[model samples]
Target: MTTTLAWIDYLIMLIYLAFVLGIGFALKKFMKTSEDFFLSGRSIPAWVAGLAFISANLGAQEVIGMAASGAKYGIATSHFYWLGAIPAMVFVGIFMMPFYYGSRAHSVPEYLRLRFDEKTRGLNAITFAAMTVLSSGISMLAMAKLIVVLHIFDAPFASLGLSSEWIFHASIVLSAVIVLGYVYLGGLTSAIYNEVLQFFLIVAGFLPLVLLGLKNVGGWDGLRHSLPTGFTHAWVGMSQASTNPLGVEVFGLAMGLGFVLSFGYWCTDFLVVQRAMAADSMTSARRTPLIAAIPKMFFPFLVIMPGLIAIALPAVQEAAAQPGKAATATSWPSKGLIPAEAEKDPKTGEMVPKYLRQAGSDEPLLDANGQKQYAYDYNLAIPNMLLHYFPTGMLGLGLTALLASFMSGMAGNITAFNTVGTYDIYKAYINRSGTDRHYIWIGQLATLFGTIVSIAAAYAAAQFNNIMDALQLVFGFVNAPLFATFLLGMFWKRTTGHGAFFGLLSGTAAAAIFQSLTLPAGAGPGIKGGWLANLHTFPSEMAQNFWLAIFAWTTCFLVTIAVSLFTKAREDKDLVGLVYSLTEKPREDHLSWYKRPLALGIVVLIMTAALNLIFY
Candidate 1:
């Protein structure tokens, strides 16, 4: 499909860029101290903080990844939201926010230092700092790649006599510059404000696409009738790993994704929690993630439905067939018939799917000789829909929204990196004591360092298969087992610092071992790259992740318990407010019904359960 950007679209995009930069520069007066720069001086309201909480996660990679997974796995991909995210977000808001807020720690790692020892804090800090930078780089890479693939800047670059290669490099650098300008000037406050803006832009940009796509697909009833069997249901085929599109059994989905990965990302991951921590009050902080969860429950419709609609488009089918020339259209479709399977082309001996290819451009992959190549590129799902459905001005707005999401993601990581590096690593270890001005300067420097490193890492991420796979690998390596240490330390008062530290070490090692042993050979460097012998083959990557997390959490839970029994424990008084049992719970009987955390949590759970049943 051919689409061109109009001058009006360029105007809209330019206005957006200026407005974002204006927000960043305007907030510079607020950056008076490290606390203000890092935590917004702990005064952000619950609703704004809640929007930022979700927007921090609404990156370019996440948008593309959600749509890609939706196309590849159907409604089963909603597992990432409903089962994998909502409960964990609720848990963080209701049970974990007390200690996080009451302790007054600048970062999550700092909390570890107060609860455990310097060693536990050090491990988490280094790991988290590294993860943030890497994730930032990935966001940068995804944006650059999208620009190249969608030709978002091609016309302007061509007018300026610039090559595609320059466009690629310029796009990455420009994104970095834009994100750094805001984040460095206003710190976390600027990032949070822009995230709220980005969230609205995303909704405004994509909601139309969903509405149009749904209309084209004949609405909800049409969608159910048009999609493949088992595609619409969330849990009907989850009894076995092989039966479900997610390729994980009910046990694995519940424990691994619903519990381990969900809790790991929401409760412990600083990316989202940083927003919650900046809330004006304990009540607001607790409500931050809860409010974020409300919209999250419905996000799959905006991000994933477009992918489903793309499959039904004639252009997508035509591109997959690669009609005429060296590539002949093999088994072209008839009206009202959606091809569900593929057969090898007799002449070319290539496996051409009868339906839409899952990945890449609607156009078939071209070889060096300009011959059509048969490869499934599911990542092109959303981009294809934009090109096909959206007009010039609307397309520009959608692309601008996409760019905004990328910048928001990058800013989120940069802010997290600066805070963690300054407070957790630099002040705690390098300087011991620094003035408020000195630390704020250090945070600015950290932002610069993070931006440069992320630029480098974005180039590295270009070598990965895709963003979604790269993230899954990171989770298996770090987050799967990391949650175990936090779970024990926060709730189990007897858990020693040594037990917590060693248990974390053992759990991470177990995850690596499980992944390395099961990962197949020649799976590439980042995605399931393994050094040891391949011990087993998993039904899918998600299945492997489920089992890997299960093992990691189980190992850490057992090890922490066993090691704590043998080691010296801290006194209960020292653990007051940090440990759940020792901390006094706030009485909510006097509070309004809707304002109570437990009441809100129960409502969220009930709504989530109802969604699962409806889809099931």
Candidate 2:
């Protein structure tokens, strides 16, 4: 099929890029000190920070991966949002912000030092710094892949007679340059400002696609009727791993995702909490994640719906057939798999490739052993829909929105990486004290280093099955057990630094062991075999991810408790503001009920529950 892009679409994308660049340059004057550059001088308003909070997480993986899941798992994919995000966001805004903001630590690893000890801080700092770079590389890779797959820059490249490899290289360098230009100048403030802008752009670009696609699919009722059994309901199959689309039971979903994974990401992942930490006041800081939770609750509609609709498309249905499956009216040959000697089309009289000539095209894409590839490349669901449904200018807008999302994700990771590098690692280890100007200079250098490493990672991310799967794998390795360490250090006074550090190590080992034991037959790269025997297999990737999180969290919790009993605890006086029991509660403001965190949290919870029921 041909990809379309009118002049107007190109113009719109150009204008959007120029607008964001202007905002970045405009904020350059605000970077006078390391604090201003790293944390926006702690002067950002809650609403702006709130939007950025969600936007920071809205990378290419989020948009394309979530939609991919929607196509593959149906409405059940909403669990990633409602069960895996909202509750934890609410918990952070209402309960965890005080320690983060009140303690005034520059980074999460610094918080680990203040609460535990330098040893604990060292482990988190190294792990987090590495994870940020790796994750940044994944974003870079995913965006470059999308550009090639969707042919976003195809027209310009074709006019210049460039090959697809040229398209991939150019996409990577262009994105890296744009992100480095803005983020290097204005630092975290620029990233946060651009993120808010990105949020609007994404909404503008995708909202129409969702509306038009839903109309084509006959709306909610049509989606329900057209999809397979258990595709529409979120809660029905969750009772047991065998029944649910995710292959995990209600207990695993609720505890593993709703508690462990969600808390680790929303509460402890500095990539997000860093945005909230920049809020202007205690109240704003407390309210930031809560406000973000509201928009977050509704995001599945914007990102996931395209995939749900794509599966209903006649072309996609035709392309989704397995190797031995019988042909049906809806089935067609998969794209990019045509053979040399193909038959002519009856209607158009054009030479159709052999692989795409029939409904159950016998010449399917296969491996060396002749095994069929995936039923469908679900990652193409949203891009395919965008090409089919959107007009010229609108299509440009959608592509620009996609580009903006990728940039924001890269910027978020880079900013987090630099802060941790400068404060938690450099300042803590390499230098005992430094001038404000010196640290700012170090931060700029760190950004350059991060960009270089991320470019390397982008190449590495290609080996994974999909962006979402790659991300979940990273989370299992690092973020899964992190919450247990933080939870004990924050709430339990007896949790010694030795215990916290060892527990973190123990939990990570458990994840590795469990993951190795349950590595599926065709597990992707980074998932090695032979560490532990494969005794059991998971029903789906999502189930494996959830259970991996559960095992890690439980192991950390138990280990920390046991180790703390044998180790000496820190004094209460030193734990002020860091430990919940030792810290004083914030003075209540005379603000109305709606302005209170409790009231806003309750409202968000109610909305989340309503969405779950609606989808269920």
For candidate 2, write residues 571-590 as lDDT tens digits.
88999999889889876568
Q: What overall lDDT goes with each candidate model? A: 0.83, 0.83
User: Candidate 1 clashing pairs?
Assistant: 358-377, 358-378, 359-377, 359-378, 360-377
Worst 10 residues of 2 by lDDT: 318-327
List the candidate 2 regions with Cα displacement exceeding 4 Å: 161-164, 316-374, 462-475, 520-531
* Cα error, candidate 2, residue 184 (Å): 0.8
The total number of steric clashes, by the backbone 3 Å criterion, in model 2 comes to 2
